[model samples]
Structure formats: C-alpha cells, structure tokens
Target: MAATVTPENPRTSPTISRSVTHTVNGSHKFVIQGYSLAKGMGVGKHIASDLFAVGGYHWAIYFYPDGKNPEDNSTYVSVFIALANDGSDVRALFELTLVDQSGHGKHKVHSHFDRSLESGPYTLKYKGSMWGYKRFFRRSLLESSDFLKNDCLKINCTVGVVVSAIENLQLHSINVTESDIGSHFGALLDNMEGSDVTFNVAGEKFPAHKLVLAARSPEFRSKFFDGLDVEQQEIIVTDLDTKVFKALLHFIYRDTLTEEVDEVSSTTSSDFLISETLTAKLLAAADKYGLERLRMMCESRLCKDICVNSVSIILTLADSCHATELKSVCLKFAAENLAAVMMSEGFESMKENCPRLQSEILMTIAGCEVDSCSAGEKSQSVWAQLSDGGDDAE
Candidate 1:
C-alpha cells in the first residue's frame, strides 16, 4: 500500500510518492495524500506546447512576485505556468520563481500548494492572458506559451518542464516562450531591418516590394531606402532636392526616422511636417502590414477632438469604414441637435436642412384655426344625420 502526507513546513516543497504494499492475504492497498492543493493551484502539466496529443489536460499555475491578484495586473503584466504530464496518473510539480534584473528571486510572495495531481482526457479553452487559466485550464496551459508571447504573459521554463508536459501528459504539443509570438515579431522587424536583421522574417528571405514601397514615400524614404536604381535616383532628386533626398535616403537606410517639430517651422518644413506625415504614413503602412500597435494608434485617434466640422467628416468616414460604435454616436448626436443645426446661418446651404421648420409660428396659428374649422365640420355632420332621421319620421 502507498500513502502520502504533508509536513508542517509550509515553505519546504511537498512531494507525493507511492510504493506498492503487499497484504497478508496477497491483497494490496494504496495510501493517498489527504492535503488539498491551495486554491488556484492545479495538478499536472497537462498541456502541450506543440502538436496535439490525446488524453492530456491543459493546466496553468500563475505566479506573482508581490502577491497581486491576477485581475489587478491583467493589463500591463501577467504570470502564467503551463504544466506538462509526468505519467503515472499523479500530480506534476515544477519550481517557480520571480526574479529582478539582478537575477535574485523574490521569495516573500512565492506560494505553492500540496495537492493531488491527475490528468485525463479533456478539452481546454485558451483566452486572454489571465482568463486563460480560468476558462479552459488544460487548453490554456498548452496554448499559453504561444498566446502570451511579448504582449503580456511572462514566464520561462527549462526544457525538462516542456518535454515532460508533452511526453508524459499526452498533451498536443509544447509552446515556446512569448512562446510562439516573439519569433513572428522578430521576423517582422527583420523584414523592416533588411540586412540589419540578425534573424530572418517569418523564417523566410525578405521581400523586395516592401523595401521599394518604403523608399518611394516622402516620409519613409529617409528611413527605409538605401541603394536606389538610376531612374529612382533621378526622380527623387528632381522632385526633392538632393539635400532632402539625401536625408530621406539616410532614413531609409537606417530605419530610424527621428525628427523634432523644428521649432514651429523655424527649421525646414520638410524636416518637421514631412517627418510627421511620414510617421502617420508609416503607421498606415504598419497597419497595412498587419502591425497590431500601428493599427491601434490609427483607431484610437477617432474619438479625440470631435467637433462639428470634423464630426460630419468622421461620421462619413466611420460609416464607410464600418465603425459601428462611432457611427452610432454620430447618429445619436445628429438626431438630438438637428433642430438647432437647421437654425444656423449656413443651414440653408445644406441639402439635408429642413425648410418647413422656419414656419413653426405660422404652423401653430394654422393648428388653432384648424381646430375651429374641425369643430364646425363635426356639428354639420351631426345636423345632417339628425335631419335625415326627422324626415324619415315625417
């Protein structure tokens, strides 16, 4: 028989071991641990990083250095732990820690649980960083290494932790750190950097079209281009002075386009406005290239500085772009202020303006007169009916 028990030392790591016990009648019994895993701590590294495997449970144990609740730090930071299976229908365990730049572990808030671990065939859901654990524990654990990546999820593990989770748990596969994400980002940056990238983009050779397009734009030429064809060289020089073209070329080559506002145009306007335009253009380019942050910035500017003149433009633009929330707000505002809008000096010029509202005072007078007229009509109808009945009696 085998039995597991906990010790008084809360800090000392707990282990559950089993050994076969033989009885006098050739019967056998197993002893089990009575201790419960601390709340939020789960048994088994039931998740795989890559390759779906059968009969695996995805499991994650989050760690926090300062003991902050996972919900509080959901925005800027997260701690996630994926558990791999270690066979034998037993709980899996791993050492966890939080470290600073100096590589010293933060021990004060570190916590662990002593609980029975087991893995079985199950499905797990992977969601946001923190919510991953809450939704599909097993799936979240397996997929998290890929899902968390550079945005927020933070943690690292030795290869053993990964291998065990994959091999023993029968999990689909193991995820790499930033697990699957950093490499893609690095690849994109690699494409941006050209030969300057130490790593390749998406594990493939850089495409030339992006470089050429970046070279052609006024804002990006300084940052993205280096060597140009004779035709491009001549065209750039003709449209832009050699000095400006040279600056553009420098930006293209370095991929570092930094410029100040130039003291409100005291300096070259090209250096100021051109660079800002380039920044906006590059953001657009990034969005086109599927850069998440660039797209976010483009979208974030919509609700800012909303005004009468701009609101109409924004409304139309948002509608064309299918921005439902923005369109709803604009429509509501238009409905509420439509009356005042029609009274403005330029209201007559707008095709949508209502001219009938100008006669509101006359309409009130007509309404009163109509009530008097309607009263006379009702009396005539009644007299006609009464006269018909009297004639019949006669």
Candidate 2:
C-alpha cells in the first residue's frame, strides 16, 4: 500500500570500466657437466650460468656445488637465481628443478610455492638480489641420486612475472575502413609497363623494376647497382625454368606464391596436394638467391608433404641445402619408415648419388633404435642388428 519512489538519473550513475592485467611465465634449462662442475665445488665459488632473457629481464642460474659458505661446505649444495638486468623491485615466482633420468620418476623441485605462508612471491630488488635456498640439498644424497647422471646435472628454472597493463574499453560506436596496401602492390607488379630490367629465363622474358628487385634481394642489388660496369638492362638466368622464375618474381613482389599451387592434380591422390617438384625447385632457387624467408616457406611446405615415396628425394634436397630442421624431420620420417622407404626407387637413386647421405641415414636410424630399445641385452641386440644392416649396405 505504500507511496512509490522515482528512479535516479541514468547520467548520474554511469558505468565505469578499466583494463585487465595478466602474468607471463618464461622457462630456461641449463646443463652443466665435466670440468665445469669440478670448478664450482669450492666454498664461495659461484658460477653464473648463461644469460637468458625472460619477461623483459635478463636472468641466470647460479650454482655453488660445495655451498656458498665455509660451514655449509661438504654438507649441502647451494643454488640461487640472480637477476642480470637492472630493474626496480620486481616480483616473481621461481622454480628450480633437478631432473631424474634413471628409469625412476622422482624429480626434486623447489619453488616459492612450496612455502605455506600467506606471504606473496619473492621480490628481487636492484640487479643482484638472489632468491634461492642456501641449503638446497645434501651433497652426499644428491651425488648418489639419479639427479646426478654421468658427473653432470641438469637444472631447469622457470620464472613467472606479474605485470600490470591497461586495456581501455570502448564506450562509443566507431566505424573503421580497412586498407588494401597488398592489393595495390599486386597491381603495380601486374602492370610492369615502366620496368627497367628484363630477365631471360629458359627462353622466356620476365620484366622487373631495378629498384624493386634491389630492395627485395641483396644479390639483385649487387648485380645491378653495386658497380659501374656490372649494371645491365638485360640479365640471363639459364638455371631456372620459366614457371619457377615466374613464381620467384611473384614472391619478390607480392610476398606470396601463385594461385596455381592450390589446384590439385587430377592424376595424383588428394593427399598429394602441392607439387613437391615445384617446391623443391623453388627451395633451391630461394637458397641460391639468399631469400631466407622464401626458402623457409618452401622447406615447411616440403616437410608437411613427406611420405614414403617422397622422403628420400626430400632428404637429399635438405642435405644439399643445409636445411637443418627439414633434414631432421626427413631423417626421422625415413628412420621410422625404414623398411618401406628403402624399397622405393628414390631410395636407390639417393644411395647411388649421395653416399654420404646414406651413412647419415643409417646412423640416424641406429640412434632411433637405441633410444627405443631398453638397456642391457635388448640394447646390445638392437645395436648388433644395426651393425649388420650397415655392413650389408656397404
């Protein structure tokens, strides 16, 4: 039965919004062994590990094998995390781990989270403040543990940094127009009316701008503008075919491959989508011209299309071009599919032409077999089989 009340003004109670903040974590792993470990065994002898940049600050792991103090020597091992870069008081959470590699699954980990106290993460002030356990572990116990393998130990450190950032909220509607700079460049490439130089590739002419070519490639720059007599209006490229040259020029101008690559061949299976032959040729040309990004693109494409029929040829190309990542991928694939790959015609060609590649492949296969084989009798049996195969190949 009561009297009604009026609502407050909407303008007086306006909604307010602020930005969000988040944390980022970075981790680094360092392995110390051999003579380095012996040198770090003295009291007060601390070695600064290799510097790793994480969370905008340079950080390092400090190891004191015999402890940092005279009293703790022979009883405990000391380890610390140090900030190598200059900064104000920075707050971070850190974890130091000694990996266990002896069949057992026991790994020793120490971190700021281990403490049950209500206090927050450790705050490092200035550049040199250290945050770690002075008595990390007992020396005798660690020496006998799986953490120490072959007189070497692996230490992994992860740092979690808390940062404050603001992201503004849009309170008003806005309209934006997207720019099409790439399409404009594509148009410029297609309309090559004022081209200054021409490349004759396999009886076909490809007109290009001298400044544009020079801007994209150092090799082109050297060939055109580096010397007075070296400058030429027409250059002959006899090594590459017309199609490969066209694709290369397209990448130089448009930063992309031609659309024909998307079209599938009617003869081959759907799995064989891209032309491996064309990609291999392009990779060689890109390597020859020092186009690193283009070469990487070609390598990545070849890596994805690897199969039993293509592994041998891809391995040969990868080795010739010194494409490390692609070579590793090809080797692993060949090793896993060893019996089937060796039966292919491409494998025979690789064996006859590239003897060094054959040796590398055999060694890689041996390594793979050893990793999967258990220790003792089974490991020796696997090694014997690998040896027999190598002798037969020779």
Candidate 3:
C-alpha cells in the first residue's frame, strides 16, 4: 500500500532543475512605394516586401489593402510579417511599427515586448506563419493620418526567436500567475500575427493559424494532415458564403460567436444583428467543418425563431444540413400549421427550390393525419397528395 502524507510528516526533496531559454532579435525596415495605388488591390491580396533574414530564419511582410478578414468588409488596411522558410515549432515574439510620416513622433506600434505574459513566447508550427493585424488601421483614418505621405508608407518589424535548453539550476515552488490562455490566443487571433493559413470564401479572404484550426476541429486536422498538402497556404472555399465562413473562423479560433459584427437580416430586414438566415448558414458550415458544438449553438438559435413564416425554409435547411432535431421541430411545426405554412412565402420557396421538401412536408402532414385518423383523414389526404415528385426534397 502507498503511504499517505500526514500533518506531522511531509514530503521533501532537493529541486535542481533549470530551463535555458533566450531570444535572438533582429529588425527589418520595409518601405512601400505608391501606397495609394495599393488600395483596393482586393481583400486577402497583398503587396509583398523583399525577404529579410532574422534569427537564422527568413521573413517577409504582407500588406492587404482591403483588410485580411472578409467580415471586416474592406474597412481597414492589414499588415503582417510571415516566416518564409519551411520550419516547425519556432517560437518567437514580435513588434510591428507603423512610422508616422510627420515630425510629431507619434508612430503606431503593436508589440509583444517589455510586458509580463501569463504564457511564454508564441509558437509557430510551420512555415508561412505570420504575425500582424487584419485591421491595423481604419482605411479612411490611415489615408488621412500622418502615417501615409508622398504616396509612401514605412513600417518596421522586429522578431525575437525564443531558444531553449536544459541546464543545472536551483528550483523552488514558485507561485504561478493566473490563467489567461484564452486572452493570449484571443490576442493572437485579433493581432493576426503568426497566422499560417488563408481561407478564401466567395472573394473575401481570412488569415488564420493552422495549428489552432487543426486542434479545434477534427475535420480541419484531416484537411491539413491526412491527405491534403500540408504546405498549401491558401484554401479556396466555394460552398460557404463569406460571412458564414468568417463566423466559422471566429468559432474555430475562440470557441464562441463574436458579437462584434452584425448583418442585415434577409427575412426581417432588421439592422445590425446575427440574423436567422446567417445562423442557418452557420449551422451548415459548422456541420461541414465537424464543429458539433457550434452546429448545436446555431441550431438552438434557429429553433427559437421557427414560425409559420419561417418553418418551411428552416425545415429545408435542417434537412440539408442534417440537423435532425431542428428538422424534426420544423416538420412537426409545418404539419401542425399546414394551412398557415402553405400560405407562407417560405412554403412557396420550398416548392420552387426544394420539391422534395414539399413532398416531405406533405408526408409529415400525412403522418400526423394517420395518427389522428379520427380527425378527418380524407380531407387531409387531399393536401398530403398535393406533393410534387422530384429530386431529394423528401
């Protein structure tokens, strides 16, 4: 039997462990000629600076005219410094400075320096890893600020690669800092630094870190490692809408839907909110990406919005997205309120775009009528038999 420690007896041992870690620092200055012309080059598109050597590695800078995130909608300019050579598990710190063109000496700077962090230096898993900002500065603001002058802009990037080894040293039970990994990762995502992947959806581009995505979603892990090319930096996503793809990325990075952006509702014409349609699309994207929790979240929100005006549309989406719970709710709701649903604009759309859904709706109503045969079966049969026969709507 193992012995248990008592108040009178304590376990004690000599601690002599040491970690040898330090950073090799370097800086690169990049000048952009014709900064004015670089505007509107397209979202996710970049003006690349010449490669520079730093800390035994090669690095380069990228400037995005229309912002790096699709959801930002071209409202800001983006800048990021990236590792150019193939590497794995390279850890580092970075600082980016946007030079003030005027003599005011008020330059904009984003840095991970001279501050105590809950976590150590960030780790980059592979090449093409980047660090910077998706919205470094607002477009109109930057255009008018002292940073841009004479059609040129100057920027500086500093990299400090973290090195580590084992060494002999004294150790003690030191008090650790409070947990802040979420905020650290959140900072990484918002800072857009050390991102290694670019996902293009419908013309909008989003930059993200690969290991983060792979760790969060199994589907992403498979896409990155199992069969696909690991070094494929840019991925084109054609099926999902730009907004849908952005929300997916948000959930992948942070594990929650961000409340920063809002959309115009297609169904209600509401201003600045997460609309039902967007949620439904998000549910589909989440399912596709194998983000089950996010899918459930979207499905839950969509569940509360079901009504006669939206049931058919919701039902069709649920069917396609394979959201069994949401689909069951929608089908039952549609069958119980068949008259109101048929008169709805959503029902008409279902008839046109998804004839199988029309059949499914009819069949669901027929099933309900069968259970309630005493509630006039012949009359319900007339409506149930009205379903069109066609492609997979059922």
Tens-digit per-residue lDDT, 112-220, candidate 1: 2221134322222232122122222222342243323232322332111111222233325576654544354335544554433221233333223344445335333
Query: Worst 10-residue stretch by lDDT in candidate 1?
Result: 23-32
Task: Please give the CA lDDT of all the candidate structures.
Answer: 0.33, 0.75, 0.78
How much is the lDDT of residue 120 in candidate 2? 71
Count of residue pairs whose backbone atoms collide, per candidate: 30, 0, 7
Model 1 stretches astray by more than 4 angstroms: 1-296, 340-394
The lDDT-based order of candidates, best leading, equals 3, 2, 1
lDDT of 2: 0.75
Q: What is the Å distance of residue 294 in model 3 from its true position? A: 1.1
Q: Which candidate is the best by lDDT?
A: 3
TM-score of each: 0.23, 0.50, 0.45
C-alpha positional error of residue 6 in candidate 3 after TM-score superposition, expressed in Å? 17
Candidate 1 vs candidate 2, TM-score winner: 2
